[model samples]
Target: MLNQIIELVADELNLDSKTLTKETRLQEDLNVDSLDVVELVMKLEEEFNIEVTDEQAASLKTIEDILNFVEANK
Candidate 1:
């Protein structure tokens, strides 16, 4: 699941999956802006068949956060 999330994020961001780590921050590390984050959330929902609320999306700061959320919710 972690690997899948990393791949999805990397593809969406046009980045190398190998460059992403659990500690990678969505904004600071990945340079993800608000629009990108919204798109990412949409992609994640489509991929995982889950609904991520605005509050939950706002709380995701790092790759690990996303992973943990998906693990818990998926």
Candidate 2:
């Protein structure tokens, strides 16, 4: 599941999979903007069939955060 999320985000962001890891900062390393984050979350919600609260959404700062969230929710 972590790998799949990473793959999906990497593909959407046009980032190299090698450069993306659980600890990678989504905005800092991937150059994702606010809009990109929103889109990414939406995609994740759809793909994982989980709802992300606004607060949870706001707290997502890194790939690890996303991975943890998905694991916890799923």
Q: Which consecutive 10 residues in model 2 have the weakest lDDT in total? A: 11-20
Q: Residue 31 of model 2: what lDDT?
A: 78
Q: Quick one: how many clashes does candidate 1 have?
A: 0
Model 2, residue 27: what's the lDDT?
74
Off by over 4 Å in 1: none
Clashes of each: 0, 0
Whole-model lDDT values for every prediction: 0.95, 0.87
Candidate 1 global CA lDDT score: 0.95
Name the Cα RMSD for model 2.
Answer: 1.0
